[model samples]
Target chain A: MTRNTRLLMSMIFWAFIIYLFLPLIMMVMMGFKDSEFIGFPIRSWTFKWYQVAINDMEVLGIFAYSMTIAISTTILSLIIGTWAAMALGPTKFRGKFILFALACLPAVIPGIISAISLRIYAQSLDITPGMWAIILGHTVHNVPFVTLVGIARLNSQPESHIDAALDLGADNVIAFMRITLPFLVPSLIGAGIFCMLTSFDDFVRSFFLGGYEPTLPVYIFSQLRTGMSPEINAISAIILLITAALGLSAERLMRRNKKKV
Target chain B: MQTNDSTVRLQNISKKFGSVVAVEDFDIFIEPGQFVTLLGPSGCGKSTTLRILGGFIEPTEGEVFLGDDKVTKIPPNRRNVNMVFQDYALFPHMTVSENIAFGLEMKGQNKAQIKKRIDELLEFMQLDGFGDRKPDELSGGQRQRVALARALAPDPKVLLLDEPLGALDAKLRKQVQIELKTIQQQTGKTFVFVTHDQEEALTMSDRILVMNEGRLEQDGSPKDLYYHPETTFVAGFIGETNMLSCSVKKIDDDYVVLDWQGNELRGVCRSGTAKEGQDVSAAIRPESISCSAKKPGNKGVMKAKIIHRVFKGSFTSLSLEVDGVKDCILNATLAGALAEQLGDEEVWISLDPDYLSVLLR
Candidate 1:
């Protein structure tokens, strides 16, 4: 490559990175600004917004609600997704490709479309659109992610281990518990974190399906309509920190599991 | 421990997958405390037969018996048989000790007894002091030993090994073969080992069942299969041999005269029903033929030119081209000293009547 091409490539790469992170960096910076209004030129440093954001009872309650939904979604998705993965992971049967495609439909379709369809379905069924409805929607959306992870892990695992377990006087359930489940731990941890993050950060789905009680993302969207404040920036920074921590821990767990294998 | 009553019998078993017949009319009765090997080439149904005996797969027809009990419909976990898979299949998540103790734990053995049994097996398999390590931390041979130890912990009635040393290097494989034989003898348990390697089978098994094309070709002691093969397949598969297509010219009381490429060769009539003017195949082991530079006063000696001589350490293999035999190449393994002196020279090859194996085509 010539000097011009190398320079152009590096410039484009940095430009892409800056484009992705510029808003996040600005939000974090404004969280420390003393001014009530979020503006560019000059801001005195203050931690008052952080203090106010942490102390707001309504924001804390909404955060708790999001956590509850995310936790429930993670558990439900993990259970159903693991069963689906085990059924589809290792064997060939008729219509397997179609079944797999249908399983992954929620992930492939746009989130807003699924959210609107789910709301309509819930209304037709005469179900109240509230926390339970949102939880159901999130579970359906995240099952594919968990299922894909489980399938990948199962594909790498040898079937001989289960056979050996069975040949050693362990029945099917014992073999599964002793060999298959332990082998799937790393993928389970990674997929659980992924499901939790997906639920916590989801906006459009919650906006459509959530009833009187608002989730953290919906609450933040409402707050933005009122006005862009430093308090919102403070909360976003905290969420980013939590997400980074979770991502790092997931990476560490996977690396450690790989070394063990 | 119950070696005396652990006779396994596969009664006319046949298994088919889809339309492909994996095993057909496979029948074998393993005596108590015998070390039997299922030996064949790849895709020859040896592994399938072993799996069927282990209750991993149900045979499409026929019954399986352990001693007097029929176990045709039994699941693998319910049968008193264990297998060492070709890949070892050691549990990666568990430590070596944990893996070996798994079966005993499932049997509801007390903790102390399980611990004691594991220690004994670890020592017996020569894997002492490595119990705390995971399988990934061990070498290939070590992992195999661990797999064997795990299978032996519960003391199953019969242990099946499916090419367990297939993953090891050549040197390690030879060492494991000896160790495995010694272990089988010491345990006095019925062991049914499967391998595609003919030499491994000959070295380790008390009796070998050779299969080809989903059918049992021959089953006997290794020496019986090698020297007195019942079919042409067994004669060629067990060892290096020269096969001469011939027709019986005359059958004497104890000897048969074979007409081969316009040359008359006399061989001992081992086949009881040899008839005159019948086509047959004459098999001669390479080691049995003696090569000499000077013509010997032997009745069955033939003059041949040395086409190629491969200098193996213990013996030199000479490929001979005879004047009368134009269609077949005769191979003979001579002593290294004699082979060195007879380079590219015309020599007389003598086939003793006792070493010749005659098979009906």
Candidate 2:
């Protein structure tokens, strides 16, 4: 309430931010170090470590593979989640709460538990441990987030919008396509970005379900066991920068959309 | 052959939600090119009836027809009627031109025709430069006009409006009411509007259907309802009225004479058949009471003292208490500025018998 209290609070908040970013800052700084082994005394810094990761053909391949899995997961979850949202948008039947909870259950489940269960499920179905398996695991995890965002956006939409479309001589399908789909575009895009980020950053599921071919996260994780190096730090710093940029933009979009409606 | 080209016809329509009766045994027939309004208080089934006409709500029991076709089983999209919702419900994602072009697109109009219609509607609504703006970019009044333009683009058999101007301020509402009436006339479209504002109903409707508690209380013109309300609810709901209890003395060919406080007052018998020496209820508009400084020897003149005078912008309202009345007061409105001499002064008040509505108890 007072100036002293405000000053103290600001200091505390900055301290918390610094604590949260200390490791990420150190990791990024370590990528510029010329030393083979990481240490605080940066007597010299070079671009060789960054060049090593950037020029590595295997790292580049893993990046593309991870992007493919993320895209696939996003597309699958988007379809399933939007349908789930539309089905639940205006319903008032009994068991609706249970149905909705089941749809969102994967998001709250432990990631490792889901990873083990998905690997087992894939095995029982005789689906090999590979890209399909990893994509399936990522989609199951990402769908709940997509559905949650989609439902919130859909519910906030005016019921009369659909009615207006129908009154304008649009059939039900046409109304959804013309009115409802456009209305949901912003939220679906937000959810899509979120799915890609989460699927790209995912490690446990890809580790359990991936084949000899590895995604970027799984690949980085395997490289970590070989021993932590400046090149590994460089790759991680690039990933951190990417996810941070995507997350900040998604948040800004949601805030702007919130103010609009 | 059964339908006589009525734009909309509802026969014995009723809707029950669980134990609640939303609309019961309602029947209305709307002629083409007429501006009709369903006027009632909230929860009086006026909106339900409008929705039923639009094919958005299926009546529990009834037949709905748009012109000669029975459309009771049809959905809203297939029906020949469209609605301007209370909130306007403009598509936020679409620009003004896109919104106006939507119905035309659905009508399968070519791009050229759609473009022409959009331009025409934009100019018609006076939103020419605002064509590329989204709904959120426009003000409330602009959004409302955009919604109206969208509904009108389809050229439907009937246009239903559910209190579309209920969201506007008083000045804007009055302006829009005139615009709506003008548009209805210019387009030659049958418009069935729903509203609780009696003033709005009177200003726009060619015919007004007064409803109360799911029943058709009265169906007539604005002048008819205002001058001769059939029931006490209709009398009170439409405008300010003095519901005075009086005894009918005798029924003339045109007017019924009633005895109020030892004076004989004449009132029109509009509700039911009048009887001799029977207790009755009559509705008298305050504006109908003529105030005189001098005691006039009129048939129904009453000496009253002005209890309070409220100066409304264009008129002054005077509250009067009759000499013989107990614990009761009557109201009279004097137009324009009045001299202070008439304030809080005893004056002779006479009722215009033609404006007095008599009802049987």
Choose the strongest candidate by DockQ: 1
Worst 10 residues of 2 chain B by lDDT: B336-345
How accurate locally is residue B207 in candidate 2, as Cα lDDT from 0 to 100?
Answer: 100
Deviation of model 2 at A64, angstroms: 1.3
Model 2, residue pairs in steric clash: none
Q: At residue B232, give the lDDT of candidate 1.
A: 89
Task: Estimate the overall C-alpha local distance difference test score of candidate 1.
Answer: 0.90
The stretch of ten residues in a row with the least summed lDDT in candidate 1 chain B is B1-10
- Estimated TM-score for each candidate: 0.96, 0.96
Model 2 agreement with the true structure over A1-261: per-residue lDDT tens digits:
999999999999999999999998999999999998987899898989889999999889889999999999999999999999987777588999999999999999999999999999999999999999999999999999888988888888888988899899899899999999988888888899999999999999999999999898887777778887899989988888889999888888877777776
User: Candidate 1: which pairs clash?
Assistant: none
The CA lDDT at B333 in model 2 is 88
Q: Categorize the docking of model 1.
A: high
Listed models, DockQ each:
0.87, 0.81
lDDT for every model?
0.90, 0.89
The C-alpha stretches of model 1 lying farther than 4 A from their native spots are: A124-126, A251-261, B1-4, B268-272, B340-344
Candidate 2 Cα deviation (angstroms), residue A165: 0.4
